[model samples]
Target chain A: MSHTLHREGRRRDLRGEFIVMSMAAKGINDAGAGPKLRRFLRIARKHGAVSVSDVKSVMHAVFTDIGAVESVLRDLRRARLGLSVTVTGLVAPIHRACCRSEVAEEPHTVAHSLGVWGNRRRLPSETVLSVMTMCGHSLVSVPLVEQAVASVRAGVCSPRAAAVKLAEPCVCGIFNVDRAARLIARLARSGKRR
Target chain B: MVQISKSKCVCCHRCALFCPVAAIRSGRDGASWIDEAICVECGVCVRNGCLSGAIRRRRSPWPRSVRALFSDPVTKHRSTGVPGRGTAESKTNDVTNRIQPGQVGLNVELGRPGVGTSFHQVQQVTRRMAKAGAGFEEQNPLTHLMSDRRRGVFPRELWPERVLSVVVEASLPLEELAGVLKELRAVERKIGTVFSVSVYCRWADRRRMLALVDRRRLLPQAKVNVGLGRARRQR
Candidate 1:
């Protein structure tokens, strides 16, 4: 009974799953991959596809994927979906990759990066720049981070609160609060001495 | 990277309230001003992110032009002339001829949805890859920031420049993946940013990649890109 109700609820929302995973079958002779394309589109439409991205030869959907829908896709056949299924590829969150290996090379220095800026601006201190650049949309600024830094040092706001406060402007929830707090703490300490 | 129509704006703070990064600040006149340094260009505040229809996209010039490409899904990259942020189909190693056999494509995507990374962070990874002699995807937008391709360094001038997110695509000998991973892990510790990675290799090397993922203690989650746009013809 709950499952049925849950599915009815699912129809409206993918159940808060924001991560969009898209699958594509690539390559074609001269006729076109239209049928397969339509099949993928049909499935995406059925699932309430959020954002459909067109890339010339590929159509990628940044839509929510979940369990009830997963089963349907699992049973999905190539012929039914429409395509010869020549090659398969994947796109995913870049963060999941964390592997350990020995490094024979040294890390790059900040000095070398400041290459010919004419009258252009130099990014703030590494710490400030790090915290400010967390949002992929470039919505965070150094002044705001600096203000947060000042507040944290003044006891006006805790580092956690400051980080949370800074993260408020971004709606994606991709802000790194833990890292922001650490940076805020560091920036606050630096501010205290200044 | 976001445009606000002053005339159309009702001074509604809904966009500000919903903005995850808090990049939107109101001026004394009640007009909302976006700090470019912090704005990652995500259209949340513009595309239905605002009920007032006051927010829109602001086209940037030259180096700053990259804002829309990486931030807006609809903006086409001026460099590659492609419609997406990362490299064309090449990022997938399909027909782009960018990545060849026995090679693994290591995409160090700097920045998440909320926590966008800067060219400064992207440079850290690119420089490391460049130092190791890894080939960057020529068509990738991030490569355009390389002040010196040889040194794997972004021009110092552009360092202060920030973006919501960027993908650093590089290809190296499959065997050298370990060293790159180690350097990346080290970077993870020093930099106060959050980023993820994507490793693309031949299907034959899937097991090896999974083993590396297991070794790193990471979850084996991946997004599949099924190219439905390519047209197929019968023989």
Candidate 2:
């Protein structure tokens, strides 16, 4: 009876954590929230299987959003529940639901955000995710771009500043210098350059 | 000969940083010196560093081969002109056959005779040989591996093993000499896995002796100095 009660308490804790994470993920996916949600979720999926500390480290690096952190915490809880359920030998019903709903929804949400971001930019959707994963913010965030450009103009930034501003981690990572230069030149030509 | 005054040496380490071959080394006195054998006489050190006016080229007589090429009758005739009013043919032949000391003039089969083999062709042949043997017979890898092994067996070889030598005047200050040496060593280290270096200051600066090696046999004959005319006079 004591064991049963302990298990029940753990389950409740996990459910609470999952609820918090799910709500945060949903909030990030909301229209106009930017790509922070998908970014966090992708990070969670990539690193969530590791220790909670590892997941948190990845989160701290990649996501500045509070909601994203909450989502990660919840995902951890859900992972614990999934592990616990699997251990308890209650396999059939849980397996069906896990395969149908949990597995499908997570990637779907990530794909949706990628599709949205792709519509506006020529960058590969995966590249956007990678940038968000490493930088902790959306690629199109104005503040980040401005800061990066400012650093470059001041001669303090490395050679990859403009690409980095566009969400590339480094200069080599964005092998699209011509395209970027063209964009900048076009902007400058049209009086729209920053 | 080039001279480095004692007061001008700063030890900022720029010369050491840019030497294409790591033939330079910093001495305990905080001055730089050149290892002659390792320095390629590239003049990169003299050009890049030496903010103190410490490094200068020495003067020496021109080599006979070079002088002979320039002193040919055809060259003298071209330069002297024909009895105040030279014929156009003589002028044209003089112009066509003229061989400047440093400039590599193109060979004209019908013009004046050519001298030593063209350096451009030599370099091209060397490049082709390098490329042809780059995959299997390249010496760099063997040299590197041997040097690594030798370091465990011999410690003294570390400083003198992998250098290109250059010549400087005997009057060059110890500090300037050290600077040049240090610069060359740094450059060598950057280019390859430099295992050892040794510098021989010849005639007090007229020339530098360098003993350098990677991992294989010791290369002890590299030398650097100011070219012929420059090595003879101390400047």
Candidate 3:
């Protein structure tokens, strides 16, 4: 899920983005991963995670709220399931949240994207990139984002509904619909102003 | 791996808009067809679900099947036993310590932001990174494609294959990062598709590494392993 690391947006625009992924070493710890992950999902939902991707070896829960991330981290730390939990988001806030959770350690490491490079001249606007990058696999295409914006500008569908449509192709299940809705609404408003 | 069923296609041409690479087009018969040459097999058209049931996914033979393995998240690469274009790089580093201090893990992601890429484009990068003295990560899915790791060469037969994205994972000493970025920039114009550069490093060494990279070039946000895991890497 390293691709999830490069989501585009301003600091405020990305405030609602936080993805927590849990995985166990394939043969060694994966024996009872199912039940441990079920409990992880339960705790995530309880803390207001917006979406959850439940699979056999790897699972992810996305949250739009930092408080939820902090709470989940604190709870998971207490649970001590021995599973590796990784969080993808802004470094400072994640560091601050980890500090608050009293993990007693700074972030172990971080992956920072140098943003998009090479032949980016014809790429979509930053707004579109912000929304499309949510699906790290690029399943959310530029045309789809434009279609969503057009639908919202034409009043053919609600922003939330259009956001849901845009989110359909992302199989990673990491696409944050709530944040996409907000960004889609913002994109529509900008298009209208233009 | 996915194709538009000629008989079922209504030629509404709507599905063409959903294709990231613009691979779908209307032929002389006024029916939508996918250009196999350009289709990255991302399955967007099929996943969108054509009301006419026009788009369908079928497994391809070996080597040709590699397209879906790299592009489709639902299709797992048997070698890595992981879905998506690459491994769980620095995301799980808190416990794994895959990237140790004084070292930087660089992921050169080709064919992103809706512009798909072929393996040949990926080789252009791997070759340059290799020349810069970077070591390729053994477990990365992209490395599995390399016919020669030292030369960053892929099998000649697979060079034409395209995918939504391919992540070239390599590592180098922290001090050499700036030079490697410069090397990538010099060759960036040669690669036909767009790609992004991501840097992974231990948190303690981030400050020094950040000093080597242009702050303006980096996205404001980042991905961090916040040390919430139970297992700690012992020095």
Q: Pick the DockQ winner.
A: 3
> Candidate 2 on B97-194: residue-level lDDT in tens?
12122111110110001011222222222232222221111111112212223221212323332212110111122233334334433333233221
Task: Give the clash count for each candidate.
Answer: 59, 88, 0
Instruction: Order the numbered candidates by TM-score, best leading.
Output: 3, 1, 2
Per-model TM-score on C-alpha atoms = 0.59, 0.20, 0.94
Candidates, DockQ: 0.07, 0.01, 0.57
Error of 3 at A72 (Å): 0.7
lDDT of 2 by residue, A1-194 (tens): 00000011112222211111211111112232224334444545553322111121111122222243334444544443211111111112222333443332111100000011001232223222222222111112233333434545555745355543453322112123323333333333343222
Please identify model 1 stretches exceeding 4 Å from their true place.
A1-31, A43-194, B1-8, B77-83, B88-101, B213-217, B224-235
Ranking by lDDT: 3, 1, 2
- lDDT string, candidate 3, B1-235, tens digits: 7888889888887788778788887899999988999988877788774778888889887687888888877776564344445666775666666788899999888888678888888888888888888889887777877889998999988889888888888888999998889889988877678888899898899999999998998887787776655553333
Per-model C-alpha lDDT, please?
0.51, 0.26, 0.81
For each candidate, C-alpha RMSD in Å? 12.5, 32.1, 2.7
**Candidate 1 vs 3: which has more DockQ:** 3
For candidate 3, give the lDDT of residue A174: 88
